[model samples]
Target: MSGLRLEPVTFAQACAFVDEQHRHHRAPRGHKFSIGAAQGERLVGVAIVGRPVARHYDTGRALEVTRVATDGTRNACSTLLSAAWRAGRALGYERMITYTRSDEDGASLRAAGWEPVAVRPPRRGWSCPSRPRAGGEVEQVGRTLWQAPGSAQAPS
Candidate 1:
């Protein structure tokens, strides 16, 4: 992980990486911005941050780390996560959040100073009677929301 460094990434690039490497979720439709973890010239991971998916947390000052995908690189995930909150705080966002499935441990989140805020119940899917939708690969699993604590250094 010594050679790993954060680099500015385009939305398309981040989405592509997630599509190719993520374990479950697909690339998000959009983002406020994207950050990448690179080891020398190869991009090892990406983090996409944008408005919260839950309408309730979509306050103007809130941002969510919608997708984080890594190519099994050591420390890549935690590094990107820490950078995300730094970027969020530098932009004046009051809150930053992300989630991990109930079965997944949040070691990276803990390493980045994020704390668990909720244990969300499992959902059948995103499809509902009111608005039609297709739940992607992994939707039925319950998840835990993790929120970044206080402020941090500016964008990393």
Candidate 2:
């Protein structure tokens, strides 16, 4: 498997890679994923999959793919996400869900067998940053409340 390179990304690494992906794709935070694509030592693309957001549909045990993007000429989102799906399945996730702007080139996602399940209406509200103190350090951490739709308070 040396020829195939896909791996889990740290939160900081995911932030950086997602920033690069969003720079081109304009993906929103709710669609955040945690995988990176690389060719040898060079980074190429990223794919993110997590639970559905409160503003979106519920994907129970269904991973919601937030964004996928490539750098330069290397198109690696498919490979990365395929690996992620396999990993997700291994971890007991049953399905994957995703949303893309109608104008975005999401053919790779379609080709990878993700079909549109719901369309998000245009957003209109201002969102605030959520930062809390941890061990006396200010940290930007996701609130584990029932944030996602159809979610209950579960221990993290």
Candidate 3:
């Protein structure tokens, strides 16, 4: 990951990068803003931040890291997480949160100074007769919620 640089990137560019490089190979439905990591001229990773998907977390001061995709570059995920928190704080957000699947190690989030707060149970896929959904692997898995250091705890 030589010459690694972090900079703001548009949603479209970040989505494309993530779709191409992420192991999950899925782009988020939307994002408020994104940060990109570049090794020299090549974009290697991106973190997409936006309002929390859960309505309970829709407080004005909260933001969530919706997706983090990296090209296996060392420290790229940590760099993006740290930068995303800084960017949130700069924009007057009081907290930043993210989730990792239960089976996935959160080493990158921990390295970025985020703390695990809770383990969310697996959710049944959102498939109603009216609004069918294409379930993915993530939906069947539990997740661990993590919050950036110094952020307030989420409301119960």
Candidate 4:
């Protein structure tokens, strides 16, 4: 096992890391909590967890990992994800979820024991006729939704 360790991370710090390192998505606007993975004094990765993005799942009992960024450190992503779930569970959360682009392999999520439960199709963008908002630089790609501790609420 790696000497990767988990520590509390401020939302700002976590967001900064994600902004600098994430392949596509920008940092999230807000988060409920954040965790960092470190090998000694250096931060190797970060995870930001917040209320579920999907209205249907935003029941105050579920949390979503909005961002995760790693400096290519081994096991850093896996460690941070595991800690994120543990922290959520400790806070009495009933479910934890996160989404990965369709192109991602999700090896770290799988290593952290999260299972893919759904595949969400891509939309044109966040902006539509109802609300006129700026389109993001990142393309709207299909995403895989993953949940921790398996398929308790998963559909057949």
TM-score of each: 0.89, 0.63, 0.89, 0.90
Please identify model 4 stretches exceeding 4 Å from their true place: 128-138, 150-156
List, residue by residue over 16-58, the lDDT tens digit for candidate 1. Answer: 9999999988898889999999998999999999999987788
lDDT (C-alpha, whole model) for all candidates:
0.89, 0.56, 0.88, 0.87
- Please give the lDDT score for candidate 1: 0.89
Winning candidate number (TM-score): 4
Q: In candidate 1, which residue pairs get closer than 3 Å at backbone N, Cα or C atoms, i.e. clash?
A: none
Candidate 4, TM-score vs. the true structure? 0.90
What are the root-mean-square deviations of the candidates from the true structure over C-alphas? Answer: 4.5, 9.1, 2.8, 2.2
The global Cα lDDT (0 to 1) of model 4 is 0.87
**lDDT of model number 3:** 0.88
lDDT of 2 by residue, 34-125 (tens): 78777888767777676765433454666656666667434476676566677667677665555555455555655555444445455433
lDDT of 4 by residue, 1-156 (tens): 398888888988998899999998789998999999888899889999999887778877889999999999998888888888888888998889999999999999999999998898987776768767895544678999999974247322
List model 3 lDDT by residue over 85-154, tens digit each.
9999999999999999988999999999999998999887666687687854346788899999999778
Backbone clashes for every candidate come to 0, 3, 0, 0
